[model samples]
Target: MNPARRTTITSAAVLAVTGGLLTTTAAPASAATTCTSPVFKRQFFANTTFSGTPKKTDCDTTIDQNWGTSAPTSGLPSNNFGVRWSVTRDFGSGGPFSLAVSGLDGIRVYVDGVRKIDLWKNTSTTVSKTVNVTIPSGSHALRVDYVNWTGSAKVKFAYTPRTSATVDTVKPLVPTGTSVSYDAATGKAKLTWSKNKEMDLAGYRVYRRLKGTSFGSTPLTTTTGTSYTDTPPPTGETYYYEIRAYDKADNVSGGTADQGVTTVDRTGPAAPTGLSAHGDLDGMVLGWDAVSGAVGYEVFEKDAATGSYTLLKSLTGTSYLHYVGHNETLHTYVVRSLDALGNPGPYSAPVTSDGIDRTAPPAPFDLAVSTDSGDVRVNWKTPEEHTRDELDNYGRFTVYRSVGSTLGADAERLDCDYSTTLDSANDVYSFGCVDPTWAYATTYTYAVTFTDWQGNESAPSETVTVTTADGLPPAPVTGLTATPRADGVLLRWNASTDADIDHYWAARGVRQADGSFKATDPCTRSTTDPLTALCIGIPDGETAAYAVYAVDKWGNASEWTIVDATELTITPGEPIGADSGALWGGGGWTMPGQGGNVQWHCEGAVCADVTEYRVSRWNTETQTYDLLGTVAPKDGVYYQSYTDATMPLGSISYYRVVGVLSDGTETVAAHPWQIRPDLV
Candidate 1:
């Protein structure tokens, strides 16, 4: 005997049919059990006939059971009990099926109350039968009944669809109640539908397509569940979805009505192309080809060749004018398009601009003016960068001059142009020009401006005012006197009384035999200091005279103011002893330097009186003696020496020697000596 087959039972109301009046009830056990499709609700009765309320009820997945001479349950006698199993479900496009049963007692199988398999006899041995039948499509019910009279009680039954592809050619029904929803944030389209009713259904196939396009031959995805979530392109375009059912036999049904969803507008417009830029007098002009689907445009600009770009402007037009003020600077730019929702597109290729510089170089600074001999000289400085690169915009200077206190537009533009020199030491450009047209004893105003090659002029520099010098020389210097000293003759005088005195000139020379001075040269003194002067290294035993004059800024000069009534003899030192015995060597003396070399020898006690020796070189051009040096005597040395390396080659020169005693008495040579380096 086979074992009883039991299955899990769910709770549901039980309906009873009596005299065509349906009534709902439950057995005395506890509650009625419900079963899903393909599982059967089973009932048991105490008598062989199926009547009255069932003694027991439960769910059964299979209809095979056996009870060997024992009660089928707690209350039913196994020999006289009967059992029934029934269920209703969809078969889709219904097809051929087989119903089989085996029993030791009586058994029958019916489809919708029509018997397909029967073994109705209380046999001591098991009896079996099978029947083939065709069922129409849609919902239908099947039932099996068995009864046991005595001895062993057993029953088995089964019904199955003929699933051979060649025999079952019907496809599943179309999936119904199809619908879809969209989640904009996730860019996903969710599709849902009522579960298909086909018992042979394998799964559902979801299809998608763009609007105005047909669905593809292949499905987007296949799902065993009734719902699917699909990700669309999210390009702000409308898309459609459809649901279809496929069977285990590889048969697919027609698709349901298409459902549509419009995705979020996440895409922006295309990048702007054909961008261009050019320079105008006042700014840079830019243009580009129009972009499709673009509602506006964005312009970005950067000042230098390298750096991040920043937004310059946004507008609906395809062209723009970027105004750059007062500088010749290179500007780089890029452009992009924007949709109605303000989504930015790819940037166009970058462009650099050639812009005009309306700005002039900075005004010349630190302007100064001076007047001499009715000539006005102007000097100024400018930033060093102005002389390099684009900062060097101006080609020349425009000198403006006025006759009165203040300069105005009516002032004259000097006819001449001026250039500048870079004063690298000061890190500035130095500019100077002369205006020689002013009259003496008059006040004038001066200003300067830089002008570019295009004639654009910068703002004027600070103006300078100057009063011309009076056309008169200053009075002669007063209280002039000359005093002899060990180094030279000291000349002193009072300063010039004239406020515009430019400088004082002092000249001295040896007095000639005819009571006239010979070849007077300007003395060594501070030309800027008008009160005092020094005449250095005067040859001993020579008579000299000194004179001074005061010169005005207008180049006028006062009469010579002779020192000591114009005949002051300068005797700087006494004559050396006649027996000093100083004599120079003939040739090949290794002098201390090149060009001119001289060495002298002295003997006798007369040399003991010499504290130092003075060496002098004659200048034929100036008719004066240039002091070479002063040397202290070396004790016990045989000779004294000197070298004039600075003397030019191939020249004949006369040099003199003088001695100073230990008592501070200056001594002169009775006779001078001659040297011809060219001969040596």
Candidate 2:
């Protein structure tokens, strides 16, 4: 018998085609070989009947291959043979699908053993048919059978999900078996889940949110794989995640259970704002708006425009007071908030201010007391006369007189019967006042001070004591002469005849519109130099008279001997000097200390030429370096200090220093110093 003729007899008995349907009496064949689910288990039969799969068996991932007029595998007949492909798989959330089959002789398809596509007939040309079907969810079986009876043989079959939005509306199944792992060191969260079984599944979406917040509409990521790695904000917050599956048709499944993670807090609180500074007699007062999550605030201070901001203080309140003692130097300030975890936020805007004036001038010194009949004269040296430093903001002199032996706070403040004299011979500026209400034989104590325009008074000068005498006063000064010199009127007289004469008192006064003589201030000269006396700082162009009297060792006084002087003018000369710049380490701190500090070295010629250095702080709002104060150069001091105890903290600050010559010439620095306290 011929090889093809043998199959023709068996095919005729086992199969028949009528009305585009296949009728098969062939028994189902069971294979000993196995294939993984979702992969087609293929079996070849020698006869058209698929009974007893002894010819060949294998696995195929898909059924779209074309076996053209030849055996699909070795030892299989090219004609008069049959091939069967079967698979059982999960069609999760199953939906509409397309079944396509084409073949020359015959082809058929069955879903779960129910026939769906039938084009079974021996033909010379290839026959094609496509059918739509719905597959239920869960495990189900599919089978494709092809038979070649005679002529050229070829077979092709395909099964695909219908993914068009108008055609398939079914969603993918929710992912399951979700788990997560976290790496604290790298701050990474990795999530994994079982892949969805839907053939139309597009991908999975991962969502994350803070623990207390709801998940956002947008997904964090979308991936086709079963695992994903994410990086959440490392602000030491608790966060949650959810997984969802979506289909190619844009249908999405419900989200899985929320997964949670706690991350390490590496973020700081927000910076405080609305920072403000105010000057008061107490100190520099700083305040700012409180931050939402802050537990405390740190105040930093520096000299305005001149040094690095130092940590002034840390407190839980929104306000702070920077105690700077008796100095009213302008300072710059910044503030930062701290979280409970001690993380610090950015600094606030810089603020500059010079605190209210609370500083007083040095006290007057060299107090002397003398007495005349019916009056007592008090004399003291001005602070400028002793120190010769610039008497800044000098207002006037205050003389206190006490009737008791000891001077105390209750001492009487005398009226403005004051006078200032520059004695050229003695090179001293003296102030004197005569308590004309005095009585004879009375003891008195006197003290004086220099006061600023603000009425801030210096410490009292050393006290002077004297007692009026009971006996008669010395004879009046004889041969009284008044000479007008450049500085003041020079008075000359013969020595007093009384041996007990202690000192002579001279009073100068401007004649008022009334003819009565009004004493300005009484000057005192001891008996050791009673012949001559000089009155200093008597203004020019004034008709003035001088009266001289004698005081005994017991404070007795003689009657006045008057001498009038001609008008004279004393003119001041023009100041002169050259610019001597204040040089330093680029305006930065030369040494470590409290608050912000700026140091400069100016010795030799430059130090000798410049009178003082002015320090300033940068003011952002004003766009200028506001002056803090002046620093004078010492004769032998090479390094000068510009320290700002109230520097801005948690911010970058700028500082500058300029030198001033005696003639009012200014020398500026090459560049302003930049200090980043936050970075440090």
Candidate 3:
């Protein structure tokens, strides 16, 4: 179809029908229309009874002549012919008018004796046709034909005028005092149109088009209201609008000229309040009070060091969670307000805070003693301060002590007075406490320090002191040993000689490559009366060491004696031949060192370290030996017994042994006892 012609229909005759010129109440006179229609005009199509058929003398008749009859042909059957006739008094040019026709089978329309449309067919199709036709200025003839070949024939038709197009012309009738406004935040546009100019005007149709485009004929509103609102338009856009006046007959006046408007949002949202920033494991969470009428808030985060800010989030709610990533980085934040139209307001003042460090400070360093007898004094220094807070104000210090690496079951908060002023002077602090309870000649290891509000604690100040307790335990029983036994390690210690020492205390630890020892347990146990203590609960396969100390009921401890007893000595059993179907029993030593047993240590479950076997022959007068065959570590079961087969017959022979560890530790000795062929 041809692009419908864009036309402005304006006629003095139509205006005369309205009786007077019309004006818009609010807009300029140049933007109003003058044409109007009746309020009670009937809509012919809206009536359901009027089908496309010719019916006679129904409704109001516009034509004065009776519908002409169709002449019947002799050969044509009477049932093959049908006709319908109807009349409508209201008809005009420039319309979306309704024309109803009645007929059957086939039908045709004629206005003023001129064929307007042909809708006739000899089949079963409906014969009614409602055609939108242009009419000349005056009254005219209207006719319709209906035909049927073998079915019933009927007729019906009517006419009701529709609203005329109203766009791109003089201003249509708009509500008086019409105005336009905008919301910058939400990007909404409001349009207020004038009420109907004529009492008969049913309602108004609001039309809008983009800037530089033709006004669209279709109206956006069919309501009788004087105002309308367009919500959430795209940002940074301009819209043009117009209005049309529609009579009850649906005849619309020409549209008003386009009103060009560039919405400038002036109202800003309320300033965000109660801003807070909290540090979390993932990042910082920023929260604030939402501004009323604001579409949302915009968050800006700034680097504490550089004072440079970046847009962090444009959140639709009041709160925003921001992940700044690294803990070392410092951040500050601010919020900006936005209006309903999406116009952002100025940012509120910023609030700054530092992230909390939950991590504990490094262990106290350089433990030393400053006093003896009446008071035992300790001194230590902390790591460099991570925060700007003064060191002197750090919280109270707590001190802990143990007989050995294993701390005592309870930690005592030392009441000893200490001064952080030393930190300001030389980065050192001292603590002192009187310990008359300590036994003479006994030694003790002490750890001490204080932590700041940020959890940054000073390095521990440790001191080994010989107590004044009578008959102090014999040097605190030095050279304690730990050896593997069964599935765990056995801790043993040298005997002490303090006459008054009722018992000894042994402690064991797993040795870490970092030289730090993790205590198996913090509590110390008394050795079996008068005998060394053996701890057997250590986990297998872990390297362990032991320390021993002497303790008295007065809560005094002797100096710690430590030892590394990881090595073990054992005789290798005879290895059975691989073809003998005998499984090698013992694999490599279960206890590689003195501490911890090894379970399932073999590489493949069946394979074990192999070694060379030596055979020796002895003469009656002189001793002589012969070298024997060698075996690979992987050739036999780990620590099982092995027999030498290459020994000379009738000669007494003996074998000496050599074994190597995984890390190349070597042992040379006589093992697997001498064997002679005659004796075998």
lDDT winner, 2 or 3: 2
Cα lDDT tens digits for candidate 1, 1-680: 21332222211111011101112222464357687887898888888889877877777888777767777765687678898888998877777777888879899888899888778877999899888788898889999888888889888888776667777677778888888999764668999999877666789899999999999999999999999999899688999999889877778888899999998695777899989876544367788999876879999996574678888899999988787853656778899998766778999988886576444556888999987556678888777743543235436777899988899769988765344688888889888887757777888898988765455677999999989878787897898988664334567888877887877777786555766544376654533354766554323535567888888878999877775322233322322223244433322211111334445565556667888888776565676667977777777666576655444432334566767778887664522332222211
- How far off is residue 341 in model 3, in Å? 9.5
Instruction: Compute the lDDT of residue 429 as modeled in candidate 2.
Output: 79
Provide the RMSD of all predictions against the true structure, rounded to 1 decimal: 51.1, 44.7, 38.5
Residue 458 error for model 2, in Å? 81
Q: Which candidate gets the maximum TM-score versus the true structure?
A: 1
- List the candidate 1 regions with Cα displacement exceeding 4 Å: 1-36, 267-680
User: Candidate 1 — what's its lDDT?
Assistant: 0.71
Per-residue alpha-carbon lDDT of candidate 3 for residues 76-116, written as tens digits (9 for 90 to 100): 23354443332322232223345666555555666667776
Query: How many clashing residue pairs are found in candidate 3?
Result: 75
lDDT of 1 at 670: 29
Angstrom error at residue 378, model 2 = 99
lDDT of each: 0.71, 0.71, 0.48
